[model samples]
Target: MSGTDEASAREALRSGDLTIIGRIRSASNATFLCEATCSDEVVHCVYKPVAGEQPLWDFPDGTLAGRELGAYLVSTALGWNIVPYTIIRDGPAGPGMLQRWVDQPGDSDEVEPEGPDLVDICPPESVPPGYLSVLRAYDHVGNDVILVHADDRRLYRMAVFDVIVNNADRKGGHILTGVDNRVYGVDHGVSLHVQDKLRTVLWGWAGKPIDDETLESVAVLGEQLAGPLADQLREHITADEIEALRWRVGALLREPVMPGPDRHRPIPWPAF
Candidate 1:
């Protein structure tokens, strides 16, 4: 969708009649594929109700929907547009997060690296030199695969975004390739935590210098975090969480480099 269409879709999600069409069987929470209508404009959306959220010891109960919205706000503020338009409202299952559905043709084969050598599913040797491998994985048939995501700049931008938000559950499955071929990150319910817990599949740029453009975006986001964005985020997340977000952004700005994996477990389980 065009920028204008997306803005209109965001509005429709905020003030539309959301009708559940089907349920997405998720292991963590109840998610619904929905259609939202407003003034004859219909848009597909994903609805996650607060009541369906499974409680976690690390995160407080019933706050997942709010965090989903919080991630969208952060993405918008940074001008990254990594996450889709999302809002918190009352759904059939009560209060929840409603995010505009990204329509992709189908899942793309993700690239993964297996140790020093890239997996040979598609002949990694054929891939040009200097290509950075993002992650390692096994195909449905259990064959090894190595993904080279650096060719797409959107994936890199999303990796930077994950650092800013402290996203703890950035699994490969959460990354969607839209019809427009843009990489979109979803399932951000476990983000914006008060402590450091960034688990992600986009770790190909570890220890690399942050580009000037990305650094500038980070600066703008840092400024917004202290202004109107901060005000809006306080409505969804705790003050401590907001403070932690600010700290994370500041840390990235200061370091201005991609970090290596955490000393503890860095990649999420079932990475894909």
Candidate 2:
């Protein structure tokens, strides 16, 4: 999504209106980058509803709410600013996921666009120093911590939802860099895989070393998993899921790196 188009789409979204201005081919859906109009804000959202020939990897039992809710949960756990969203309406194509658009900072006297590409927030140079660092840390910790901290407890719960639904793409591009310099991830219709398809770039720092702060955070999260966090997951996810979530977290803490999709190849490389 380009900056100009993002602006226009945001305007339409604020009005609760939608105009399918363009199309994109994602691994899972034929995405339409549209302008959405909600009651108070205009957003440029990429609508991914059910339509067209089913992909080879589609999860038959997947629901839009399930996917959005999972992402929302994880974002909340990471202390990232992701808005609550829904796939409210169906388009000509089919059902679509409606999400809040992450606004880019304008090149003003006070707010300089520090990131490399406003479209896709990227490496250190493009981003305002501390911004990307925080995001990377969140990704690193979230991927490794699992059930340790309260925040990460929610994150693990969400990850379980992703596993149950078979989410195949948790790539960096799916994450959004909000105007406030916080990170928010979007897109999760491809989760809950019965197979091990956790492909992402958020774990690049794994196995190299674990910091005290990070290790301590993970330990806290692990303890939570058997306590209040465990109860929280029981409400939404199955008991098996809670156990699986704990197991995955335990595995990471034990070794930290065991090689997944992102470890070997680019899992949505060149994320902006």
How many clashes in each structure? 5, 37
Question: Please, what are the lDDT tens digits per residue for candidate 2 over residues 145-250?
Answer: 1111112322333333333333556554564555665545567655433345665534323234444444454555567677776675454445664576566556
Give all candidate RMSDs, comma-separated.
4.6, 10.3
- The sequence of per-residue lDDT tens digits that candidate 1 reaches over residues 199-246 is 876777888899999989999999998899999999989999999999
Runs in model 2 deviating more than 4 A are: 1-21, 25-28, 35-41, 61-65, 82-94, 105-167, 170-172, 209-243, 250-272
The TM-score of predicted model 2 comes to 0.52
Q: What range of 10 consecutive residues in model 2 has the weakest lDDT sum?
A: 144-153
The C-alpha lDDT values of all candidates are 0.82, 0.48
Clashing pairs in 1: 111-147, 112-135, 112-146, 112-147, 113-135
